[model samples]
Target: MIKNEIKIKSEEGEVFDKKQIALAIRNSTFDDDLRCSLLDDGILDKCQGCNLRYICDGIDQVVDSYVDKTTEVVNNFDFE
Candidate 1:
């Protein structure tokens, strides 16, 4: 794997590199709001009617904060 390459894993266990993600975003026909809505759909898909879905949703806020911190870390990372 290349150092400094941003990667995201999808719900289906597929990993996408930064360029792939960018390309998908660029090629997407959906508008920004729709895209955001799709994220909600994805969350629902992950939840799949689990009883703890609400708890997981609440934890998502913490995950968002962690992502912010991680983005900062990634921005300032020294691979050497």
Candidate 2:
């Protein structure tokens, strides 16, 4: 049997390369510099012709929407 792990950085719609990911895991850290060196621009773009595009896109939509709404709420807080 095969296992897979998915890490979603919805704030930035870019996917990291294997090396960057490995380094992050090994160092126990992830930062914007590593994130900027993306292997691919978008997950949906990569999954365009894939059979599981629909499922992946659906999940992306839900996550993106949740993040957007949460950010909006947080931003609107009266911190005065």
Q: How many residue pairs clash in all the candidates, one count each?
A: 0, 0
- Model 2 lDDT tens row, 44-72: 44544777657656655654554465554
TM-score of each: 0.26, 0.32
Error of 2 at 35 (Å): 12
lDDT of 1 at 71: 55
Tell me the tens digit of each residue's lDDT in model 1 across 1-80: 75434566679775758675444433342342112333466655554667775765655554455446555433565698
Shift of residue 43 alpha carbon in model 1, Å: 18
Note the Cα lDDT for every prediction shown. Answer: 0.51, 0.47
* Backbone clashes in model 1, listed as residue pairs: none
- Indicate the worst ten consecutive residues by lDDT in candidate 2: 30-39
Best prediction by lDDT: 1
The TM-score measured for candidate 2 stands at 0.32
